[model samples]
Target: MSEVGMNKRVMLVEDDLDLAVLIQDFLERYEFTVSVVSDGQDAVTRIIAEQPDLVILDIMLPGLSGMEVCRQVRQQYEGFILMQTALDDDIDQMLGLELGADDYVIKQVQPRLLLSRIRALLRRAAPLQFASSEQQSFDYQFGALKIDLTRRMVLLYGQPVELTTAEFELLCLLAKHCGEVVTREDIIQQLRGLEYDGLDRSIDRRISRLRKALQDDAKEQDQVIKTVRGKGYQLCIR
Candidate 1:
């Protein structure tokens, strides 16, 4: 049964007709509006024109590859990206995250689990989600970046930084654990309510995208998010 019915749309881009149909049919049962596409180029156009609530991308396609699509969307669109692909290689997973994919799911996995993951990314996470509304909202500052949990918006040196729900949640999680290293397992358990995955590069990818949104250099910056060797990550809270 499709659990995510109306009020939201899903962009599904996959070249395989059988798989596409299966996924579309499954999602539609719950009330989700799904726009199906065959390749990455069309996926980008549909995303810009329709602005879906979330995106389900395939790594291998006829043209424009999913990585490029993810990059373009990260630059402009603020929405969740769930990559459903059969590729299980580490390089592919790493590339996907480097390009800003929120979650990666290997094909043929349980649909219920995928649905749970989709909701996890789409759902809001923050200090507000953890606390109450009546409590006076406060701002979190780290170098040039500012997270207004009250407003659920990010600001960098006074400039507004747009983030998809997943990206925002990733940021909030790091900020909440500021100055401490959080492992991929810890992040997945806390954010997605699941155990660590062998292919769980989604959290890392979300963090990379958050850095780009905050204009932090991945190779040469420690102001916002700094990687700890053999550890997770640390948000340099100021």
Candidate 2:
């Protein structure tokens, strides 16, 4: 059992009884407390009530569908959500992220790979522990937008802007390098711990979501975040 998995609660929302049991057993071996909810509605209720550290949510569910469950539970629960889909469908993946899923894994993937994804998401959710706090700035402001890294909060024009964990992290990365183009390769490596395959659209989707939360128009040249054609993205400084 890995010490890092100790005390971590994971809720697996998979309708397949056999698959759920297998995943639960594998995760348990790593010292993670795992709970299984087969119904989407039940998962939402339990997720809100229990607020587990992470949720392994299946896209297809009996009661409410995983997408619906995600939309509903996100109103209250702020924990990490890792969606699962049987097929490698772009629409499903994009919709999952738009609905607040932190990341996703295909059903055919190995259990160990799924475990790796879970660990990556958990690491991102955890607060950064730096040896020297003085070297880092926990707060950043760009015009009407304000980001408080310490509090994991974002405000726009003095009003709180609701953003998922992934969106917030992307925004922070862009803010940290405001006015500088952050390549897709850099973002994938830093945020997802995966090399950019030049085909993954996850980063673009998150950027769109973040822009919407910030009320920034990507079409405008003076937008808060500008797409550097063929390069990546740049957070404009006000």
Candidate 3:
């Protein structure tokens, strides 16, 4: 029964009744308000209407696929979406991220590990608690791009850019170290509090999504976020 989970609403979209009940019970023990919806269409409708703090969405479901539900709900809802996939396939994870999923976990993942991931996502979604006055006052501007650290908002050419929580965090990380290469290990450690396994493509996927939101060409020579060969990424301060 963790106090951190208190008052937080989590909607579980797993279709397996037994599994759903198990997850719901486990999360409830942690003091989170849990809701279960087995159908994708129903999940979308309820999620839009209820607007839970976070959605634990499964890829497979009756009626509508999880991908469709994510796509449709994302158009209207801005809540954190944590996708679940039974397969450990990269395509599923990448596609889900591209479709605005904030994060994903495999169905076979341990319950405690799932809880930890959920906590991590929720922490990121929460308003920043700055540790220093400089951090509290930090904001960045590079040409047409502008990022307000305090407001957690990004503007491109005076237009608001819609970004997932993960994308915004990654962009802020890069912006904070503008013109400096922020390594993969540094990014993973700072953002996830985990070691970079060297195989995890989630960061790359997020960078791709961020680049798209920033209207930066990833393949071009003069990219806003330039990939430094074996090094990580650098935010070119134009």
The residue pairs in collision within model 1 are: 2-30, 5-30, 5-31, 6-31
Task: Report the C-alpha lDDT of model 1 over 29-109, residue by residue, as the tens digit.
Answer: 767888799988888888877888888998888878888888887877777788866865656766776688877778776
Q: What's the TM-score of every candidate structure?
A: 0.56, 0.62, 0.64
Q: Is candidate 1 or candidate 3 better by lDDT?
A: 3
| Residue 125 lDDT (model 1) | 28
| Candidate 1 local lDDT, residue 59 | 85
State which candidate has the highest TM-score: 3
> Candidate 1 overall Cα lDDT vs. reference?
0.74
* Residue 228 accuracy (lDDT) in model 1: 82
Candidate 1 lDDT trough over 10 residues, lowest sum: 125-134
Task: Give lDDT: candidate 1, residue 96.
Answer: 79
What local lDDT does model 2 show for residue 46?
98
Checking candidate 2 for backbone clashes, the offending pairs are none
Q: TM-score of the candidate numbered 2?
A: 0.62
Q: Write the per-residue lDDT of candidate 2 for residues 85-181, one digit (tens) a residue.
A: 8897768988988788878788857998888777766765554443443354548988877787755667676666766566878999999999899
Error of 1 at 71 (Å): 1.7
- Candidates 2 and 3 compared by lDDT, better number: 2
Residue 59, candidate 2: C-alpha displacement in angstroms: 1.1
Ranking by lDDT: 2, 3, 1
